[model samples]
Target chain A: MRILIIEDDQVLAAGLKVGLGLAGMTVDLVGSCAQAGEALATTAFDAVVLDLMLPDGSGLDVLRGMRQRKDRTPVLLLTALDEVADRVKGLDLGADDYCGKPFDLDELAARVRAIGRRGGGRAAPCLTAAGIALEPSTLSATLNGQPLALSRREFAVLALLMEHPGAIRSKGEIEDRLYGWGEEVESNAVEVHVHHLRAKLGREKIETVRGLGYRVQVAP
Target chain B: MSSLRRRLFAILVAATGIIWLCGILWIFVGAKAELEHVLDTRLQEAARMVDSLVAQNGPAFAAAASAAATPERYQRQLSCQIWSLDGRLLARSGSAPDVSLSDHAAGFSDRRIQGEYWRVYTIDNPAKGVRVLIGDRLGQRDQLAVDLVKGLSIPAILMLPLLGGLLWLSLGRGLRPLLAMAVELKAREADDMRPLQTQHAPAELLPLAAALNNLFAKVETARRHERDVTAFAAHELRTPLAGLKTHAQIAMAAGDPGVRQEALRHILLSVDRATRLVRQLLTLAKLESGLAAGQSERVCVGDLIEEIGAAAQPSGKDVAVRIDPALRDFTLTANRDSLAIALRNLHENALQHSPEGGAVVWNVTPDGRGIGVEDEGPGMPPEEISQATQRFFRGKRQTPTGCGLGLAIVEAVLREMGGRLVLENREGGQGLRAIAVLPPATSPCP
Candidate 1:
């Protein structure tokens, strides 16, 4: 998952980007409402972690604008506003979740993962296919109740495929979420990550469309 | 007489003394003349009786007069003499001198006898061809007048001390309420703002008591506001403290250098937030602490907006400065520093809510007297607009990083300048539009 962080405080935004990056998700940051709007316009983010107060304007200005354009990317509001009514307003404004500032980074990562798991119009945090069960929050998978360890990239590829069991995701779309700015990508990076995922969870669980991309199939 | 009781006592005693003295002097003047008239009548009757006795029994009266001795009290006051038609000194009283006492002008005469002033009366006996004279000293009538005045005034002089004591006591009783008020005021604690009791107070002192009560009420209100600000300050500080703790814990627990570096960055951010909060809190307290009131100076509105643009540029350099055409030369009467503070707050508020590339608009309102700021940020609901200016009121989930005193400082400054702050949603739900209205200057509108 690649998440965009809209925060005015440069230090905090940098810290959040690093913390979420180490959790195997690519993170992008913008310090003002204008930058956030521009970034959102050009990129398709899996989720957005928004700060309500920004240098140029409130992050809500960005949020409202995104909603007006029918951009339904999941949003998790990360602000210093902790009141119940404040959370309600954010939720009513189409935010998927609300988290107040001084929050735990681990908890924030989990929530973002939770949003990605529930993507593709599904509501579960765990996906099961071909006798392989995956928990996106823990980044762990089980084959017939047997535990298996996967590298960060391998886990990311599997989570994406598990999230959309029937849809084919192109290699370019997967590359966009797998790496962020300044991160070098190889020609076979997606193929390499998928090869490891298939070795651990059985190659039949994922189907490759010639000249297209990959998808996870439902169990027989 | 500085004391209420003493002043009343002095006035009463002095008035009584003057009136009594005037009445005594009036009676003494009128009675003195009437007394002299009666003494003169007695002198004339005595002279006629002696003249008749000498004429009716001339040899016998002379022999009886020679034998009679004058009483001591009457000796200096009276004397009698008889004269014959041939001018013979025929008979005289023992008190009379051997020389003739008067020329005997007939009814009354003044004469000098032995260096003493004398009043003399004379009677003529035509049948016997003789005249009689009686003379008394001028000093005698003066003595009588002195004796009569003393008799009337002695009692008044003796009663003066008693009257003074009574006046002092009554005046003290009349002024007791003021004394009670003084004692109550003196005994009160320094912070006490309770009203002075008005019951049992004199009608003259009720207004004073009521005014003191009003003062106490105002002081109490000020003290209460200070307390609320202090309490709010304590609560708001916890946000920075909580942030600091979160970052410190992360830095300590993390093993990766990248993770530690990230936590350190957060720690610095938390410190900055705390510092800003402290600075804002101090500014707001100073404004609400009465340093923000009563400074009327001529401030050009255009220049003032420019100053705000410069001071707040650090917050948002992209804030587009706008001045209504009519406001380019507009000037208003206000304290430059206070108005500058209000304008800065308004600008920061707009900057914090406006979108990227959105202009923080500045202008003179349609009326040309009010200075205004507008933005294209996400606007708030109508219900929360009224509460935005209250102290320590950070907005809901939309609450930003701030001390929450920005709008409050703006309000205090505007109100102290005899102006008001009006906040409304920007047209079409853009953002907030805030105005601070002050008295316009003498300069003509552009």
Candidate 2:
């Protein structure tokens, strides 16, 4: 999952980025309301972690702007204001979830994944197709009841493909989900990760069409 | 008498008792004077009647007077006597002593006869060769006045207790509103700071009720301030703690040694920030409690500055501090701890706000009434300068680690020491210069 954190505290923002990044989510950070608006307009994120008190204005303004634009990106409010009223107001403003400060990093990651899964219209905790199962919570995959060892990048690539088995994901869309801002992306990074995925998950699961993008199909 | 009701009651009762006493005295004096006049008139009448009897009934009246005959009604109150022209014993009533009633031999006179005091009236009849005397006892007149005073006193003495009771009851009725107010105050909960009802208060108690309500309002405002400070402190402390927790968690989970090193460093920074905030809060609390209050000591400005400057510097920034040499020997007679806290905050603020490797200049003001700290960095906007000292008021250019309490503490400390804080932009608009303007009394040491 790709996530954007709108927070003004530099130390906390850095900590959240590294922590969420290790959990197999590409995390980008913006320190003010203006920057958040710009990032939201330019990029698509799977989920948003918002801090209510920003330098220029409140994070609620950012959430309101997104909802007004009919952008249904899952927003999990992460703020220092843990009061019940603060939570209620954020949730009522189209937030998908609320997490107060000093929260457990594991719990935060799980909540983000939950909201992202729900936003994708999936009810199950894991994605399964054709004897292959992916558990987003543990970032683990199983093939025919055997556990498979995959790098974090390789896992992210496979998760994106397995979300909709028969739906095509263009190269650009996959790259957006895999890399955060300021992280160096190699020219063939997607191609290399997909090649590695094929060697492990079987090539018949994935198909490429000329002048289009990559897609995966479940066995009949 | 300290109680208003009791005092008023006492005054009223005393005044009434005095009036009653005066009334009885007036009646006693008037009755005594009237009794004397009537007795004198009766004596003259009785003397004249006997004189005429002696003239008409001649020898027979002499024989009657010798028998000492008197009217029944006047027997004890008055006496009659008859005497010949020669000095001789006169006929006397049973109540009168046997002696000449008067040597003058005519008209009203007072006489003492045979150890008895008498008021006597005498009539002379030279042609008839006889004298008549009427006498009354002085003791009898005194008894009548005493009896008359006694008649008026008995009822007056009896009414005293009733009068006192009525006064006390009426006084209590008049002061019931005050007692009700006291009862309402006593029954109130300690945390209930509501104002007392003034609309229904009595006219006399209006000032008291208004003053009490004003006091309650002040206390409520103070309590609200305390609550807000507590809430703000909790809110401020949570963010740093959250940062510490997140960084610690990241350090524990990082696989690469470089990432682990960076995370550990962040954890340390978070601890430092939280520690600073806690220490600042403690200092503010101490200032509020007035600990070491009003104890001023002569402190050398140069030594104090050197001690603080030698202490911890802002990590990773090498801001230079230039203290004017003229201030080295300067001293101030002020509260040592408060001055230290204020100067330390000012120094830290300047260092934190100064650009990397920039210089912070410390100097005395030209008027010799203040100290100045100038930093070479982005000064605050003019509109924000006034609100800069408000608690937790971070401006548009708030720093990441600032808790927004530095200027506020400085302002509080200065105010406690009878001084003020003056914030303004530097001359060229390159930075800000903060001045600690001391009162005239605390200008400098000789």
Candidate 3:
């Protein structure tokens, strides 16, 4: 799992990235909203850890811009303001979760994971399908008691699909989930990934809905 | 000297001195005028008497005048001088020196004889055609006037000081009540806000006393409210903070991951409880101080309840909310933040007291005035109901997780909004029913 942290407090951001990296997730830290936007445009992250107060502008504006562009990448808002109005405003603006400052590092990690899992469309913390177990934090996927070697994109696609087991995700939502703010996308990018995933796994591992989207059905 | 009595006495003394001075001036002026008029009249009377004697005795009048001119044998307080027609000094009173009255024709004249002012009258008798002049010394007239003034002024001057002293004493006596009030005030502590005793106060100060009492009543109430809020905050935060510290320490010391996780969970729960307590404490303080009264907004009861239910569900309690369909869209003018705090506290209290997995129902009904939250938990004892509203007052049946400030916060909000909180047992004797009744909104939309 790739996580992006947008926080002005370099010390706290560094501490969080180190802690989360120790938990086996790749982490990238950005100190301002501009840097966050630039990073998002360039890289693909599983989740974005956004701080409400940024050096350039508010993290809410970034979140709102992301949502407006149909980017449903999980976003967790971190803030020092513990007022209820601020909480409501953050959540109402589509932040998956919020944690106030002076928070325990463990709690922040837990909340981030929770929002990440939810935004990935997974209901449970652990993802399992067809005797395959994938741990998002470890970014490791195993099939039939054997681990599979997969590229970053393949792993991301598998994770997104397995997160929502039966839910039909539109092509656009899948594209949004797969890409960050301004990543370039080929016309048949999802199709190419689906074909490749089929070639790697079983033919029926992933199903595509014509003119709508894709769904990862439960194995019968 | 700062006392009102002393001040009033001083004022009265000054006024009396002024009036006494004016009276003395008036008496002095009147005595001087009266003396001058009397001296002139006496001189004219003496001249008339001498002229009649001269006419009766003819040429022998001069000799007779000399015999009658004795100042020591006068009928009234008068002195006389007589001169012949040729302006020669003839007969003179012993008080008068040998000097001609005047060379002028017979009339009345004022002359300085021997450096003394004298009123002299000269009479021309038509029968004798002799200018008979009779003069009386003005000194005698002025002496009489001075004597009269002395008789009047001596007693008046002496009484002025006596009158001033009496005025000073009376003014001091009249202002004793004010002095007593000052003494009482000076003796009290700065923090003392008790009402002043109205006994012995003057009628003029009654309104001032009443205003002071009113101010004291308000101040006392405000002070009591502040104390209650502080005590509640301290009491409520103590246990949860201690628990948080303990759990954090345990988690830090634990070697096993499972033990550490469990300790972390406990720490989190403690932290959550502490946060809730702090929020409630702030809400209670705001409500008690009436700080939120001016910031009231229109809040929809249904939406508010839904939000509270969502927040309450995280406690893992079986919390249910049932809004009367008839009252679904009802709105009220209240401080939304404070109202939310109050409703959340009630929900928390219910969740705590209800058996695990037991239903904690939040029923919102339109009590003629406003919305009411009726909880179903183990209701408090009848005697403890009133005490529960007080800060830091915990009932025997209260849950260990509670900070005993839930009902107190509710009470404070209700009071700040000019509302009331009623606690009673549920109909089935199942649990407590806490109702927060607010004033009816001026307008309601269904």
Candidate 4:
């Protein structure tokens, strides 16, 4: 899942970036509402972790702006204001979830994954396409009931393709999902990851159309 | 006497009882004098009647006067006597004493007859050569005066208890508002800061009620301020703690030694930031507690600056700190601890805002009333200058790591030491200048 964190605290923001990245999510960070709005306008994210307090303005303004623009990316509010009223106000403002500050890293990651999964229109925790299954929670995969080892990038590429079977995802979209802002993208990194994914899942499992993109084949 | 009702009731009842007693005494004295006069007049009338009868009916009538009856109303009260001009006793009534009532020829006199006091009136008929006397006992006149006094006083004495009861009840009715106010206050919850009702209060208690309500309002404002500070402190502490926990988790999970080292460094940074925030909060709390400046001492500005500079230099920002030579040996009488806190906050604020290799300059004000700290950083907007000293008030140029308590603590400490903080943009328009203005009465130590 690709996630964006909007927080003013640099140390906490950095820590969250590192922590969530290790949890198998591509995490991006913006420190203010203005930066967050710019990032959201440019790139599509699976989920948003928003801090209510920001140096520029409240995080709710960002959420309100996003919802007003008909953007439905899932948002998880993180704040030090643990009052019931604060929580209710945040949730009523189109927030998908709320987490108070000083929270456990594992729990935050799970909630992010849950909201991200819901945004993709999936009810199950695992993604299955063309006889290969991927468990996003554990970042592990299986082909025809046999466990298969995959690198994090390879797994991310396969998961994007398999989210909706037979749906074509362009190279730019896959690269956007694999990397966040300021993360360097090497030449043809997506093509390399896709090439490795096909080798593990069988070449017929993923199809590349002429001058378009790649997609996971649907089971017959 | 402390109770208003008791005091008023006592005063009223005592005044009324004293007046009643005075009235009874006046009646007793006045009645005694008037009774004596009336009895004397009756004696004279009786004496004249006997004399006239002696003259009209001659000696035979006079001889029958001893058996003749006195007026029915005065039958036992009056006594009469008749005697010839030769000083011999002529006739005496049955109730009269047998001795001569008086030796005077023809006037009223008081005489003791047969060891009994009498008020007598004498009439002499010159043509007939006889004297007639009528007398009344003085003791009986005194008894009538006593009866008059007893009649007036018995009712007054009996009415005292009833008067006291009425006074007590009336006083209670008059003071009902005070009691109601007490009950209202007593029944209030400790956190209830609502004002006391004053609109319908009695005129006498209006000032007291208004004062108590004012006190309640002030307490409520103070309590609200305390709650806000607590909330802001909790909010400030959470961010650093969250960073610490997240970084610790990163340090534990990372497989690469470089990432682990980076995570450990972040953990240390988080701990330091948290420690600084906690210390700042404690200093702010202590200043807010209204502790008066304690034990003034002579502090050299040069030494104080040097000490803070040494402690703060570890940040390694490469900023140049220049202190005015005029303030090097200058000494001032102040509370050393609080003064240090104020100066330290100002110094930290200056260093934090200065650019790399920039200058932080310290100088005493030209007028000698205060000291100034200048930083080569973004000065605050003119509109935000007034609000800069408020707790948690971060300016538009606020850095992400700032907790916003620095200026607030400086202002509080300066205020406690009878001083103030004045913030302004530098004249050159490149940096900010903060001045801690000491009390006007303070003078540099010689």
Please give the DockQ score of every candidate, comma-separated.
Answer: 0.08, 0.42, 0.01, 0.53
Model 3 spans > 4 angstroms off: A1-220, B1-12, B29-230, B241-272, B282-299, B314-321, B332-339, B346-369, B374-400, B407-446
lDDT, candidate 2, A74-171, per-residue tens: 99998777778778999999999998888888889999999999988888988887678899888899988899988999999889988888788988
Which candidate tops DockQ? 4
Better of 2 and 3 by DockQ: 2
> In candidate 2 chain B, where is summed lDDT lowest over 10 consecutive residues?
B62-71
Off by over 4 Å in 2: B1-232, B292-295, B312-315
Q: Name the best candidate (by TM-score).
A: 4
Question: Whole-model Cα lDDT per candidate?
Answer: 0.75, 0.84, 0.70, 0.86
| TM-score of model number 3 | 0.42
Model 1: chain B TM-score vs. truth?
0.63
Q: Could you give candidate 3's per-residue lDDT for residues A1-220 as a string of tens digits? A: 5689887544355455555544444578787778888888877677888877564567899999888878888888876555687789988998888876555656666777777777766677778886667776556788877887766566667777777677676766566655544468888888888788788777887788787787776865
Question: Which ten-residue region of model 3 chain A has the weakest summed lDDT?
Answer: A9-18
Could you give the CAPRI-style class of model 1? incorrect
lDDT of 2: 0.84
When candidate 1 is compared with the true two-chain complex, its DockQ is 0.08
Prediction 4 global C-alpha lDDT? 0.86
Question: Highest lDDT: which candidate?
Answer: 4
lDDT of candidate 4 over A1-220, digit per residue (tens): 8999998888899999999988889999998999999999999999999998787678999999999999999999998889898899999999999999999999999999999999999889899977899998888999999999999889899999989989999999999999998889997998899888888888899899768899888965
Q: Each candidate's root-mean-square deviation in Å?
A: 16.4, 8.3, 22.7, 7.2
